[model samples]
Target: MSIPAIDLMTTLRSGHSTSPRLTWYGPDSERVELSGRVLDNWVAKTSNLLQDELDAEPGMRLGLALPAHWKSVIWALAAWQLGMETVLDGGDADYLVTDRPDSSGRHDAVIAVALPALAMRWPGELPAGSIDYASEVRSHGDVFMAHTDPSASVCAIRAHDGQQHLHEGLLTGFAAPHEDGVRLLVAAADGLEAALSNSLGAWSSGGSVLLAHPDVELTDKLLAAERIHGK
Candidate 1:
C-alpha cells in the first residue's frame, strides 16, 4: 500500500534536489523559488507541526481555506503526507487552516496562516484558540516521521464540489497532463485544484512548475525569462 504522495516527494528529493521545483511570482515584485529539497523541508516541517502539535492523523479532514499560493501548496502536501484528507471547500474539518481566523470557530483547532514569504508571525492578533502557522512551523523538525501510514485507498482530496479523490488515483486520475521535463506555468486564477493538479503532473514527469499570482501579469518577457515550455 504505497502512498503516491509520499513516493512522489521521495522521487523529487532524490532526482533533482538542487533544481527549482516550484517558482512563484506575486504582486509587489514578490518572487520566490524553492528547490526540491527546500520544498520537502517545508512539507516535512508542516507535517511535523500537524502530527506532533495538533495530533493530526489518518482519516481526519484538514480544511484549507487559503487561496492558490505557495504556502497553500505546502499545506496540502503536508496533509497528504500525514494521511489526512484535504477539504478544499473548507467545510466540516477537524482542523482548519485559514487566513481569516475569526470565521473558523467551528473547527476543533484553527491555524492562522500568513501568506507573505518573509512573515515571521501572523500580522494581527489571532482568535483566542488559533495557532499562528508562520511562527510555530519553524520550531518543528525539518524531517517528518509519520506514526502511522495510510493505505493507498485512503481518501486524499475532498474537492470543492464534495468529490473525493483517493491516494492511489491522485496522480494518474486527478492530475492534469504535462510533457516530460516541461517547465509549466500555472496561473492562480485557474484555482488551487488546477495548480495542485498541474504541479503534480509536472513533478511526476520530471518537470517543474511556475505559479503566477492573479495580479502578476504574464508578459512575454516574463515567460521568456522563466524559460517556460508550457501552460
Candidate 2:
C-alpha cells in the first residue's frame, strides 16, 4: 500500500500564524520562544542546509543525537520537511546530528550543533568532516521546496534498549488530538519518546510546546508559569 504523505511544513504553516508555537527552557533558566512563522523559517533554513550542504534527500536516514533543545526540534522538523527519516538513537543513518564532544560518530557527514540558543560557534573542535550546524544552517536559503512527495514513513524512534518503531510522521505517532490551542509541557529525559510527544502533540494540534530540561527541578512551577495546559 502506498503511504499518503503529509508534509510537516505544510501542516505547520496552515496553523495559526501569529501565535506562539514553541518555547524552550534550559537547565540554567534560559528561555527562547518562536511563533509559527519563525519556527517555519528555522525549519526551512535547516532543511535547505541539509539538502544543499549535507546532501540530504528523501528516504535518507539522518541520525539525531542531540538533547531536547529547541534546535533539536528544529532539526527534526527540517528532516521531515526534506522527507528524510530521523533516527533517534544514533543507529543506521547516513548522517549524524550531535552536539556531543567527539561528534564524528559513524556517519560520513556529522552536523555538530551547539545547544546554546545564542552561541554562534561550536565550543569544541569537531573531528574532520564534521560541520557545525549553527554556523552552516543560517547561510542556506530560508525557504525549502521538496523535490518529491514525502513518504509516509517519517521517523524511526529507537529506544535505548534497542526497540524501534517507525511512524508515518512524528506527530501522527502519538494519540494526541490534533485540535487547536492544546499547549503541552514536557519534563522527561531527553529521548525520542519525550521529544516527539511534546513537540508533535502541540504542532499537530495548532498548539504550542513548553519544553523543560530534565534538570529543571520544579516541573509544576514551570508549567504554571508558562500557562501550559497539558503534560
Give TM-scores for every candidate, taking all chains together and pairing residue i with residue i.
0.96, 0.84
lDDT (tens digit, per residue) of candidate 2 on 1-231: 222123445656566556778887776777888877788889899988888877778888888888777888888778766667777765688988888746435676888888888888888677777888878877888778766766665444555555444556355544245456777776647565566656777676667877777777656776788886556
Off by over 4 Å in 2: 1-6, 101-105, 153-170, 174-180, 188-190, 219-222, 229-231
Best by TM-score: 1
Question: Which pairs clash in the backbone of model 2?
Answer: none
lDDT by candidate, in order shown: 0.89, 0.71
What would the per-residue lDDT of candidate 1 be over residues 101-155, giving only the tens digit for each residue? 8853698899999998899999978779999999999999988888988877888
Give candidate 1's whole-model lDDT: 0.89
RMSD of 2: 3.1
Clashes of 1: 0
